[model samples]
Target: MAFPLQRGLTPQEIEFLSEMEMVTVIPRQRLEGLELLSGPTEKLLPPQRATLPLWLAILLKRQRRVNIVPPHWLHPECLQVILQFETETKEYTDTFSPPPQLPGQRRAGDDSRRQSAAPLRPKYTLDGQRYYPTPPFLPQNTALTPSEASDLEREIALPYHWLEVGNMLLDAASDDLTEPDQVRRLLKDLREVRMSKMRKRVDALDAAAVAGGGVSLTGVGAMEIGEMRGFVAGVVEGLRKIGASREQARREQLAEEGSIQGYTQDDDDMQF
Candidate 1:
């Protein structure tokens, strides 16, 4: 499907965006890591645990030089507890209310609460592993524009919903799977199931949109619908392309095998 207007950043763009988020790390061995060659001649050294940008940390971790310290929100125990509660509770309601203020009045408690509520990083569970979602870029050094700050706040706030977070956590952690590989498989299955549901929903919406009418979902805007439709369509198309490519490869391999078998049979006949 051709998407005319620019909607949202692609997954690759999102990964590039999240590269600047700071993540905690503990060095496993003494090593000379990547140096900041341009700005400063500094390198991450071992024995001193430090917080570094996600991109740098990922590089070091891949090299087995550092161990990543996942944030508190990603803790399995905490996620599990949240998941259990979610399964038990039918409805969730927020109890905390914003502190009232008069004109020209600023309360310290209100400021603190606002700061606490508006977390810098938003957590999302993927394959039983929780991570903060990101967009194209969050400049580490430069000051954030008002728009950037608001975008960050919205991203952080969206995933903080108790019900959705809990459900995602539960989906990641399969009840019977203990082994890492098994749990990963379970998470993959769960993700596929969710994606299928989304695809079906999108199809329904697209059908409605095609049938001389359109439908509205609560909290979802027109722009969002277009973006989601594009995303889902992209995913489905990519999957189809991959499947076709694999099937073609399989067919060629089988044909070659058959040719070899026929050659062997002719050789045996000649010998007879």
Candidate 2:
């Protein structure tokens, strides 16, 4: 059997990748840790929350063994705040809201006293080599405890896998989420707003394709990028072809002018 080739990642593939993201889950039963390929999961004990891969969490949730704790940004209040920032904020009117800060990144408006104390802890691999993690390994979708959530310094921006993780949790663990209906609605609204913003960037694609130029995709989610990849790529390719045509015409015009000047100089020399 032959399958048609696709340009960018399909939505299902993006969702599959999101499944590797770590998320917090509250277990209802005790289970011993099992060693698996992507590192052994901690033994899940009742009343003691553990962070596990989203796929495993979803499996346990479906089996009625655990409840997935939605990340703080998945809450309705936070979504409303993010939506407002997207629609109403003057500073972000032309750009998407910023993504979550990486470790040790200092947010704007931080006090000098507090800025010096930001932590940058690196994770260790099974081989004991230290390396900083990003995206799926960053715990961006993991639920924070009450004390940790109380910190006002935590920014409520969306993570890189926002859409996929949000949709997955909403599908498999809606009961665990606060106001799942509202969360779903807000997710839809956010998607529409961001997609509109993405489509509006068509005019800037030409400039982006030029040397030393680029369009900022800092806060775009994987699913969103997959959706827009084909259209944006086509537009950029067309722009590049048009640019090449113009450059070729300009070079021919200069060459013609140089040849004419050379012919005139030769005639002057002949007369002399």
Candidate 3:
């Protein structure tokens, strides 16, 4: 039986797929995990039902690659699984106090004094590869042009919605499973999720604007799309590096000027 061969993945996604393509059977543990983190799919029509198992079998063509799971794998039932799970996670997290900081850790205040005094090694490791952001990912000291910075924002924002959906899906599935309901339940649940996300985003954007953060895509972060939080973290780390570098450079230049002026005055006063 023939399934529609959709367009091939983009070069970026293809590269990601290549690295992560060692597809193994969804382990029993993961399957059981999925049972909690993902809701059971609604029975598909004959053609629709056959796609996943088929895609799953064919997807194993690569042996030594890191497998990339597209965010949409939990589609059709997306609204039910992704959005509900996110909403629940946030509500649960808010009730808990934040974790305590460990001793010997430099707080932000102490760190400022030492920051420019030390060079930062902005290397991060993911799946064993040293991830230094060259263009979009920002990694550490990679300088970003204004356009490149804008591009980073675009790339990060693109994945936000998809991540939100995937996270919510995983969360919904994590709970104990009950008997499957009708398709309407899926649509209704999803609609509710979409609505909630919109409301949250609006509130966030408004707050960001009021706080002078420029255009803030607030709740759109780890709160909505739970799955891609790691990706978001990566982008954030990159931005942090960019900000730190600029600030460090500014402070260093100012300190150097102060030292130079002080020395010149002492030399003149001392006589020659």
Candidate 4:
């Protein structure tokens, strides 16, 4: 017996990839900076916050050397707002709540002035070429300052690795989060609500297979995509097979009609 081949990355693999996302951590002890393949880490000083990858943050938290600061979106109030947007908002009734705006992306009602005022800080490559970073490279999970947090409250959106990062922080640094229990509950509710919408949108998959048609997955997280990949692939494959069968039947019918017409024309010529 042959086993079915896997499509796309697994949830576990996606989770592992998410560990590379940068997060802010408040150190309880002093430590010297070390060079890593990605980049050199900042030296940790007592009570000073520094940005580190999620994997390193979790490791430090486990050793009681630092406390991970949860991102603004991970807060219960923010989660509540996001959940309401996903479930009750008329515009987003069928869509997932939008992900956080990318660098240099203006919000819905922003003016040109604001858009021009806030320029994106581009990262430089080893070759000194400037480029904008996305997802794991962006500091999406990093802790915000008080003023920054307040400003961000106006537009609450999850990051691409929201599920994986949230779970890791909750598991390793629950003490660092304010009302971790509520946060956990809200996360669960949000996941279920978004997943229900995903399932409902399966009817659109056939349309998505057609030219110029697609299902909007604007705010979908990495883990969610991984979870649904196999199911969506199966649905699309089945639809393609059905379409092929129908096309074959239509061609056969057309051929038979043409043959009958040709025979009639020959008989009419013979009669003439």
Candidate 5:
């Protein structure tokens, strides 16, 4: 399938949108003015289902006002299946690069493609031996955390260095040959490693900025000016891919209104 363009929103913007993405929720109690107020989607009364922003739903859930419906993918069984597949399967160099189709199956985006639970079979080469890789974890429509949503967007749209890093992280987890009970533990470790790596990169950038008197990373130790330029060029290229335009006016508006506390009613209408 053709992926959507990656441009427009910055990472920060996407995070904000994820928090604002609406989900269908069931209210446990009646809240005043709920039905009258318009949100990202149609408003309804309790104990009825309503579409509310994730942030709001989370807040209400904490207050015992609503129960957020867990997306299908987040189900324990589903997660277990995915984790099992990723663990048992050898890490492939490429998942998106023209995956192999099973007999009686059609290419991706083909009108004849069969809708079946059978997984997409991709081939992997190991020790000069060619083998059909295990079935991949098929993604589905599911509510996701801001981080998960961001990663998904990058996975399908950005397809950058981070994607390779993610795959390698999963591979590392599988290498331990841990039992099923340890899946969550390994995943937690993977997340910590990923976060630490990101933190170091941010720290490095910050240090470079400070050393350069906030002007540029130029003449900062072993860091090359060309590398900094290339980093920026990559960002611009990604933005261009998604047909993103610079919304300087909105950014300026946000800057002027410092420390905004909440989303507006209209903002709740955004879908994940």
Candidate 6:
């Protein structure tokens, strides 16, 4: 099942080579070119089957193809054949480890998840004053007059505009990143979109809470994560066991209700 780490070959080709040994050998004639590319396995298909990649059709041709694969070029896991061959040198053994999590990432059963999703209680004032659509530093009537130049900003003349300040809250959806839905949402607030939404929602809210936010609720969510993770594990195990039990009962029911094609009248009366 070894894949050859051949130069000029794609990772995809190498992956295919690994899979070949698990089922069948590729035929040399088929491997000659793309004209005869064939079955993932030979025993499963017919000869008249259209040709495939030259290496892939080797089984149909029934001819052995010799490839002087380098010791290091072959992946260790797939090269079971190399271990049996004598006078082969051993390379470094590759060991696998679970993937590392990002810093402050929440593992399963992070208790704080339930807590973080909970909405925050906003503050009442920002330095003994009521909240306003226009903060103190912002210019009065910061509207863009029709007489202004065409390129002038149509948005509030606030110093901390979202387009420049950046949003740490939103996620990107497009590959090019030109489509920011969060930015669109920010542009639609009452102040920006003229719907008068600020006072309605932030009336009693703490302004300080908004300014001094970003206390991660999900970071150490699983802080005491030790056995709490087992809660999620238990749920998965329960579902698996339930599925197995259901499958077993279904098979049993099918076996018990075997074909009744040749049953006599008495047998019919004594149904399964």
Per-residue accuracy of model 3 over 1-272 as CA lDDT, tens digit each: 99874343333453332222111222121111112111232222322211122123133223311122222223344335444454576752222111112222343555454432223335556456664322112121112335644552211111222333333223333121122243335535544554455444444443453465843333342233333334444554666677688889999999999999999999999996
What's the CA RMSD for each of the models?
20.1, 2.4, 19.3, 2.1, 24.6, 31.9
Report the Cα lDDT for candidate 4. Answer: 0.88
lDDT on C-alpha atoms for all candidate structures: 0.44, 0.90, 0.35, 0.88, 0.41, 0.29
Please, what are the lDDT tens digits per residue for candidate 4 over residues 224-258? 99999988888988989998998999999999999
lDDT of 1 at 21: 52
Steric collisions counted per model = 2, 0, 21, 0, 6, 21
- TM-score, model 5 to reference: 0.35
Q: Candidate 2's residue-wise lDDT over 1-272, tens digit each?
A: 99888887988888899899999989999998878797799999999999999999999999999999899999999999999999999987767999988778876787767752347788788799999877887878989888778888778989999999999999999999999999999999999999998988777777667755888887888899998998888888888899999999999999999999999999999999
Task: Sort the candidates on lDDT, descending order.
Answer: 2, 4, 1, 5, 3, 6
TM-score, one value per model: 0.38, 0.90, 0.25, 0.93, 0.35, 0.17
lDDT of 6 by residue, 1-272 (tens): 99865334343443343222211122223333222222242322222223232233233333334111111112222122222221132321111111122223344666773332223233346376653322111221122223532433221121222211112112211121233453334333312321122222223223323354422212111111221334434544565577688889999887766644335555877986
Question: Where in model 1 is the C-alpha error above 4 Å?
Answer: 1-7, 30-45, 85-88, 92-179, 182-272
C-alpha lDDT of candidate 3 relative to the true structure: 0.35
Per-residue alpha-carbon lDDT of model 1 for 155-188, expressed as tens digits? 1111212222223223432231234343344334
Query: Candidate 5, residues 1-272: lDDT per residue as tens digits?
Result: 99885544444443443444445567778665443232234454776666665556666766667766544333335445444443344541111122223434454565554442355455545456655532121222224446655553222111112222222223432232234345445445433433343333443443443355333221121112222344655644564444433456667678766534244434666742
Q: What does the lDDT read for residue 202 in candidate 3? A: 42
Candidates 3 and 4: which is better by TM-score? 4
Stretches of candidate 6 above 4 Å error? 1-220, 224-227, 261-272
